[model samples]
Target: MLNRVILIGRLTRDPELRYTPTGVAVTQFTLAVDRPFTNQQNEREADFINIVTWRQLAETCANYLRKGRLTAVEGRIQVRNYENNEGRKVYVTEVVADNVRFLESANREPASGGGMREEAPQSRYGNQRSQQQDPFSDDGKPIDISDDDLPF
Candidate 1:
């Protein structure tokens, strides 16, 4: 048996982070992915997918991800059932993300003195990255990356 799913899309809203009673971090968010084909009316359609992250990755995602930011999510599709307030069974299908990649950099604040990445996104492990749109430089250019910065 095999179960896997991968998607690249923009965030429909900011990820909501919370901790369990044992201090386990968790985050939930929705991703808006456009369909490859347009509708009959010639308008593109999008699918809103639910994503869930756990542990350090959850914290990283909540801290760095924001609405409208493009991202890639890799995970398994999960379906669970629960009882609602009216005593009715409700089923939810969501992606349990194991890996997430930030495809866009956050807008930098002008007050920053250096051309450093203000909002770097990391994985379960901490990683720092920066791109175009610097606040310290007048041109707002992306800072150069050293070969050492690449994780291979």
Candidate 2:
């Protein structure tokens, strides 16, 4: 009776935003998540997952998210089938994201795009506090955490 999925990964490309006939916003993108274990060739593998977002969230993601940006997606897995033009049934599996969190700073150069970067939207999924340093930064600097910061 429950269907939920949570994934943390980098975006494979910029989100494509579109509007439906009813004027509702929709976005589609792919996320590349790494596997926990290496393959027999000792190489790490990844799974490319398709993500879809709707309405305001879709607009926000398309405007702020870019290729190679680390992000967190929370949603449900969906599988639907439809007949193709060739008279074959095509089954598609994708995640319908309800929430998305940006995991990187906006100051860094994007993986592909080159243009003026606007400030991200202010929301739970967007930047919350601008002045506070992110403890999970991937800058290779040692984090300074006190005992009180630990849960256990």
Candidate 3:
């Protein structure tokens, strides 16, 4: 049972942050993804998708993400239904994001005032060391490694 979805698109609008009754942070936003093929008029079309993030990730997204910023979202497709005020059953489909990445650099600011976070996200290796202190830094020089260091 595998349920996963990955999408790369520009945000249609700024993220809307909200809190639940338990005080947990939640954010919702819409992503405008361009379709691969063009329409009859040869004009490209885009699909608007709803994205939902929870917990600390939600707050992070709310603070850093802005409208028209390119982003990548990885999550599962969720479909739920509820009765509207008219008593008609309504179904909603959205992505419950587990990971959200800002594809564009913070230096590139849109017409809107808000911008992304200044600091880059750390690598999976945990703490990020300065480039000058990195032993594996690529300085256009060949790296010296012994055969013993090569697992192959």
Q: Candidate 1, 93: how far from true, in Å?
A: 0.0
Best by TM-score: 1
Cα error, candidate 3, residue 78 (Å): 0.2
Q: Cα lDDT of all candidates, in order? A: 0.83, 0.83, 0.81
- Candidate 3's displacement at residue 41, Å, is 0.7
Error of 2 at 88 (Å): 0.6
Q: What number of clashing residue pairs does each candidate have, in the order they appear?
A: 0, 0, 0
What is the lDDT, from 0 to 100, of the residue 141 in candidate 3?
Answer: 86
CA lDDT, candidate 1, residue 128: 64
- Please provide, for model 2 over 17-109, each residue's C-alpha lDDT reduced to its tens digit, 9 standing for 90 to 100: 999999999999999999999999999999999999999899889878889887888999999999999999999999999988776655554
For residues 18-49, write the lDDT of model 1, one tens digit per residue. Answer: 99999999999999999999988999999999
Candidate 1, clashing residue pairs? none
If scored against the real structure, what TM-score would every candidate get? 0.74, 0.73, 0.73
User: How well does candidate 2 score on lDDT at residue 54?
Assistant: 95
Candidate that beats the other on TM-score, 1 or 2, i.e. the better one: 1
Give per-residue CA lDDT, model 3, range 50-73, as digits (tens).
999998888888877889887878
User: Cα lDDT of model 2 overall?
Assistant: 0.83
Cα-lDDT of candidate 1 = 0.83
In model 2, what are the clashing residue pairs, if there are any? none
